[model samples]
Target: MRRETDRTMDFLDEYRLRPDPADPRLSVAVTGVNEAGEPVETRVTVERALTLFLNSREIVTMMTIGDHPEYLALGYLLNQNMLRPETPVTGIDYDDDLGVVVVRTEAETDFEEKLRKRTQTSGCAQGTIFGDLMDVIENARLPATPLRTSWLYALTHKINQTPSLYLESGAIHGCVLAREDRPLVYMEDVGRHNAVDKIAGYMQHHAIDPADKIFYTTGRLTSEMVIKTVRMGIPVLVSRSGFTAWGVELARKAGLTLIGRARGKRFVALAGAGRLIFDQDLAYVPDEGARHRRKGARAAEDAE
Candidate 1:
């Protein structure tokens, strides 16, 4: 049998982008007290402000973990409808000292009107949507992709076991872009929206097709999450967390398959149930072990 460490290495080898939890710049060590009042040291995620600029016009400033600035800038603009998908990008300049990223396009673009309208979303670290959320996805036609139960089990197990910032620190949100049972890219941030935007930016940069991909998150399946998934053109969205009412309603309208509370062998499909294929037998599927449980899972258990 292959060693667990080797298995992890092989899984990580397939990722085009994954978290670097060991990076000193991403986190810092601090002394704290445990439940019993014993002094303990732990690493905490570091947040940096990144101001995005679309040409000479300044856009929103977001709090992030300070990785993948270019992707974040591009993704944020793309999702906000400020940057069109077909827009030619002449350059992306990121200044580390000033903490700013500028995305230059072939044509002059202005979103002063869109910037005036913003809606605060429920995502962690304060997420904002610049325009009508339904305008972009109103005519979205998601492909009828079949998601197998076997692949779902494989993905959840592998993702939970993968070493990440959430496992390293106590707080963070992760978003993964996966194909079948193999996870392709994993991005984490202070806000779930930032993580999703990072994946979007990566896809935009690589010209990757999202039709065959599955989107996974460690955050709640909220309306923002659903909108972003539909905007990315991914048919299925899954999470190890629960769902929201608007999230479920929007998923059904968009024909996007939404699955949540997906830990171990159990899951609840709130929308697009027609796309699920029950290929895996429950008898063979083991329960999610404690060792592989994420921070969200542990918090749920503690509440129960």
Candidate 2:
């Protein structure tokens, strides 16, 4: 018992976070006020309730923009500890009109007890973490990857310039699965967790390796976000937002490389700093451009 306890204690000390805006593909028309308080007609993010059914039993409803419902459903089940990694998923059925998704697994499954074990998470849109969920943290092996400042700079610039739902519509969060400085998969939703789950689901479905990847977000580095990133076996997390006390603590325990407040050429990493290679010169790194910057984003005026 002492040896097991010590291992768990060591795990507890290890830890991190890991975008995006209104995508026209996911936005709707609405009237809103501008910075000057002038009435303007434009598009706004569209969010709706999506009910998920695992095989025959109803699971839970989520509020999302519905980009990848299949991925969201599978990912949610995986993260909630309801679906084991080796479980064979037969098929995922989604009915967009009814806003319902059903994930058919090869093996018999039930979630009544799992649902009862859920605890509220800090994620927006009512995220839930199940009992024993954290146990998966022990087996999630993140690769010892190196993060360079040059790659960080290039990533931030490209993401800013990409025309997204956030640029057109305002109230949405983006998550990206990136390699080097290029984004491989970009997902957005009403809640940041949902966005992350979609990416997780996609990665799982396609058997994408997390070893050489980085996770990026436009939201805060909260504990929920950090836990998901760690469970996904992602070693590095970058956020344009700041971190929470518990969030930082968790990352440190999990040995996650946490980078937050990543805007333009500026950022701060609290844990796993050894993974960061500061290979870029500040003078050569360009500040974020105006049009690409999010509304109310930290300006480069000081660097101006």
Candidate 3:
């Protein structure tokens, strides 16, 4: 049962430069006022879905910016835990005429097991994940990376400054994979989780290390989102929106840093404050530390 949305807005397809260099350039009118308060127009790309198949079986489809179809397919499967580093992927084929990606996998996976593992997600973009529909806070590792205020600022500003299809069409969500203070990859989709999956697929295909990277999303931090980060073994998950209670609890158990409301200079650490290394104890007071030290000394004296 293959089902997909029909609301594909192909700004890129509708606006393409002609091969004839001698011809005058073409332009289209876009809605919006510019800095001079005049109606402005900018060239943008189209977004659409490309179906994915594994060994002739329909696995899933992705809604993306149509710029990187192969990468998106590969990334999506990896994030969904459908494929691991050792999984033997024989080949991948993309049919532009039909807009479908056929992936050849050698792993003899049970069809029913694969189907049962899928869960329809609430991500702004269409997302499917493995295991239980909702997360249970167990088996998530504790976070060991220290979060810095400066890193958060850079991450938020970098996300805002990244090139986006949404800025032109206002209809997409973006996901970025960052390492330390720098963003390594950015992907946008009609669905937020799909964007992250695309990135994950790319990482898996390229065998990129994700141990120290931070995953950022334009959508809310749901429990499934936390699980995705956990699957990648990444310790940090930052979002521009709020986190669900399940997400917070999972992060606490997983030892992952859950940063939410990542806008401007005001961001909330929803869980795992141990990862946050403050230069000046913003949450801890030196007086409290001294008081504790004094109490310990008094206890020792009383014992003596």
Candidate 4:
């Protein structure tokens, strides 16, 4: 049986998912003076769909460019902090007739109640609030190890070079989960939130450790994004874009090392500097006057 992530591979995989052996249309234009800059036109067929579902009897729908629906569903729950060991995820089934996903969980609970209790905050593009999961972030902890800048750069480059289904279709977002700088899971969706949820779902299903790894995204570091990373207990969060003020503040409070504008060999540290290590063999001089005064005072006090 294929997992949700596997079902998503129609876009992620090089193989075609359309049984009819067809390709989505592409757009082109002739803008040149026979090859010089002139008037041109192009056309392309893009894929889009409304994914609907009944959770606790409320109809929830997400608009997405078709790719990785299973992982999207699973990742949605995990990233939203709705997954529990005993919350039976009966099955995720697709209904072609209804054009929706049928998610069967173990028991029926007050889902709307759970959702309302969460705080409402916005993020880059389309995003939702996380009303009830703040405590989870505050209590979460990661290892006290130093993260080298080399590995951070390697991870950013890997994200840039990843094979994305969205780039092919020109309309989806991507999210990746990594361990010690190597990507272990990658996903894409029309919705950035959905892509994140899929990665979170994959981690939950596999029982992966959040403390030993990082989460990378093409999305900006919004408060909602911070909440998701915090929920996972992951120590580091990096993105190719920028961060909002609140996101950085929450990251600092949670002791998470947030990296933004991470590309090539440069990155901005928004919080938790203690977790990062400067390159070895780099030389720096201590402030002699200040150091001497402090050390001398300590030595004289100890002698007394």
Among these predicted structures, which one has the highest TM-score? 1
The alpha-carbon deviation from the true structure for residue 38 of candidate 2, after best TM-score superposition, in angstroms, is 4.6
Root-mean-square deviation of candidate 3: 14.0
User: Against the hidden reference, what TM-scores do the models get?
Assistant: 0.92, 0.86, 0.73, 0.73
Candidates by lDDT, descending order: 1, 2, 3, 4
Candidate 4 TM-score to native: 0.73
Instruction: For candidate 1, give the lDDT.
Output: 0.86
In model 3, the worst 10-residue window by lDDT is: 17-26
The digit string of per-residue lDDT tens for model 1 on 1-304 reads: 1222224424456464666889888888999999999999999999999999888888878999989999999998888778777788999999999999999987756477778888888878777778777876687899989999999999988898788888787578999988899888899998899999999888888777788889999889998898889988999999988999999999999999999999998899999898899999899888898876766678877798
Query: Which residues of candidate 4, in runs, are more than 4 Å off?
Result: 1-47, 52-56, 117-120, 166-171, 280-304
What's the C-alpha lDDT at position 134 in model 4?
71
Candidate 3 achieves a global lDDT of 0.65
Q: Candidate 3 at 276: error in angstroms?
A: 0.3
Q: What lDDT is obtained when candidate 2 is compared to the true structure?
A: 0.79
Identify the superior model by lDDT, candidate 3 or candidate 4. Answer: 3
User: Which residue runs of candidate 3 sit more than 4 Å off their true CA positions?
Assistant: 1-45, 133-137, 280-304
Question: What is the Cα-based lDDT of residue 8 in candidate 2?
Answer: 30
Poorest 10 consecutive residues of model 2 by lDDT? 9-18
lDDT of 4 by residue, 25-46 (tens): 3212223343566655532224
Over 1-98, each residue of candidate 2 has an lDDT whose tens digit, in order, gives 01112233221131111123434457778788999999999877888889999998888899988777988999888878788767898899999889
Question: Candidate 1 has which clashing residue pairs, if any?
Answer: none
Cα misplacement distance, residue 248 of candidate 1 (Å): 0.8
Candidate 1 similarity to native, TM-score: 0.92
- The residue-level lDDT of candidate 3 at 249 comes to 82
lDDT of 4: 0.62
